[model samples]
Target: MTPLPTTERRPLSDRTFGFLLTLPALVLFGAIVFYPLVGSLTTSLFEQSLVQPGREFVGLDNFRAVLDDQFWPVLWNTLVFTGLGTIAPFLIGFALALALNTRLPGRALLRGAFLFPWVIPGVVVSFAWLWIFNANYGLLNGILFRLGLIAEPVSWLGDPDTAMYAVIVAKTWASFPWIMVMLLAGLQTVPGVLHEAAGMDGAGVLRRFWHVTLPHLRGIIGIVILLEIIWNFQHFDTIYVLTGGGPAGATTTFAVAVYDTAFKGFDLGRAGALGALWLVLLLVLVVVYVRFAEREEQS
Candidate 1:
């Protein structure tokens, strides 16, 4: 009798196996993110209400109305908030990262302490800052009055001129630690030989940092700033808690505007339209960030 031949089983390719592993995550993302996104887009094309049962197709009227009504001011406020929120935290975090990168006492403890603000829940942070900026008997006002910086307590969140800045301060406080952690990690990756060489070449601290340190950190810095901008663009908790979109609509960013339009005004269509525009802005930033990240990886 002839011996029977056996067939060998082939293993799955790496790409296929990886896809199989990620399939659940992909399905979850589509269900959670893509589903709502599609719903929002569809809703933008129709006039609908949260309370009412009927809906009417309005085409682009919602977008046109949003553009005609307070859109410019809201867009301006969002830009200001995003710009300041990103820059202020980045500067503070960079400075802290540099300082903490040295051989200092209690460095580990200090790093942990610095992360407190970032780890705190946004709602709690918002309320804490709200008290700090309160018109009467607030920490900030008390300090200013004691130091003779002001004759009286200042209503930081109640003034249109200062409301946005007050919220930005809170945001900066909460955001900087993340930046610090990232930059600190980047700093650790900077070669010691480069610094030693730069120093031996008569390069001062500032010069070394500008030429050597900064170049090493340029990629990380760009990525961090982009992430910050994207986060701040959608930040609603701190601003809403601190200013409630303000004394004169001065702090009405896209996030707050969308919330107010949908919940407070009960105009789902307009809210969806505003949200659609906001999504476009965020998508642009995301695309830029993805390209930048890919370029960084390739280089």
Candidate 2:
């Protein structure tokens, strides 16, 4: 073969150098992401415990046990947590973002103060909510008592019926600021000229928003929802601190289940299987999100 010119060879060399530059990141990903993933898969195929001397390969037994056990309820609870957590934050945040998008007095201060919940650590927020939900001597009960709304304090977190909701409320408070920031950015990108034109055409505020604002914010909204789903599915710290999967496993999300299995239950095989299941679920969500996002963009 004829030798390539030096100039052509230089381009190839530059491309090779760029690839070489990215090699470190690839190695890091393999070590951090792939290595653990493969390890988890192998662990899932075994009957292993932290206290055991060695792992015993059991094929799909671990997966079958996870599927046939009380995990279904926990899985359902996780779905509920993810759905409510994502929706409540998005709705409240979008509403707040819309209200704040207009020129208003002290808007900057309000926005900054509203973000306090988001900046607080999850454990801190959980403890704060725990205090508020205390059956007696809590702020909520105190206010309700003062207002004569109830004759006695309510056990917000003690009742299985209300525990999940209590946790959801706390999660919502911690998460809404993120959606607020995202929606605020989306609102800013919405063309003011479009709104003005819509108004000139006799479109009302709602009409203008529906016709112009929403369409413009669609991409951002999709991104926010996708991220929320992912984050909410993996949420553990707040639930752990607040409820610890109680007052009777009402708030036991999949992440909490994985934690309990690995640490508390000392079942390495079950934990690894659960972790792999979560990974698969998240991967499916990501794929669906990308597909829907692409469809939205095309439309």
Candidate 3:
């Protein structure tokens, strides 16, 4: 006797189940993210002073005014700060990850030591660095004096020339551990077989790292770099606490500029306009990055 034809129905796959489970989260995001974004964009098309009773629709005037002469310096400062800030943290973090990846005495202790900077509150970090970088009698200056490296104290946060760099250093110090932890996790995911194969092929340490480890970490590095760009560009807390975008407005990025324009100047329209521009710029960058990532994945 022949058995009856068997019929089968597949259960919900993991991807579709996950998407369904996250539908509520997606709705929450639409309400929270898109709603405010739309509101801010609408606000940018008007003249809304805090002192005024009414708003006037001025079309692109707010944007035009935002792009006036003073905009260049702020934009340049933001770019430089973001570039240096991103690069320094990544380099330091990658180095830390490499160092800690190998087994050594007190390795766990060393990892925790690096994480201390990251766990501190931003305001506290700012204040701590403020004291350390003081032009007179600070630890750094005192150390320099003891070493006889400088005849005079250097005004790290006081000089416009050095203020942005100072902030970058503080931010890098605070942020590097985040990258290190992430990279270390990625390193653990790399296959040990690959390294053994490379070594068997007569590869040196540098060669194995370049060819085996780096390719394994390519996706993680790309994600980390892109995220750093977004976070560093929008970062406000440390800079706001440390410099307040001062020392001749040397550290005023788009984020700081938005705060100053909105709160200090009380020009909501202009602030909103600047914010809209910022949103557009970030969105463009994200899209380009996503396209690049997709292409890389395809290749």
Best by TM-score: 1
By TM-score, how accurate is candidate 2?
0.90
Per-prediction TM-score to the true structure, in the order listed: 0.93, 0.90, 0.87
lDDT order of candidates, top first = 1, 2, 3
By TM-score: ranked, best first: 1, 2, 3
- Model 1, position 30, has a per-residue lDDT of 99
Better of 2 and 3 by lDDT: 2
lDDT for model 3 comes to 0.88
What Cα-based lDDT does every candidate model obtain?
0.93, 0.90, 0.88
Output the worst ten-in-a-row residue range by lDDT, candidate 2.
1-10
Clashing residue pairs in candidate 3 are none
List model 3 lDDT by residue over 1-299, tens digit each: 34444445536665566679989988998999988789778889999976677899999999899898446787798888889999999999999898899987887899989899999888888988999999997888899989999889999998999999999999998989999999999998999999999999999999999999999999889878888888887889999988999988988988999889988998989999888888887887788679768877887
lDDT of 2: 0.90
Q: Mark the regions of model 2 whose C-alpha exceeds 4 Å error after superposition.
A: 1-12, 293-299
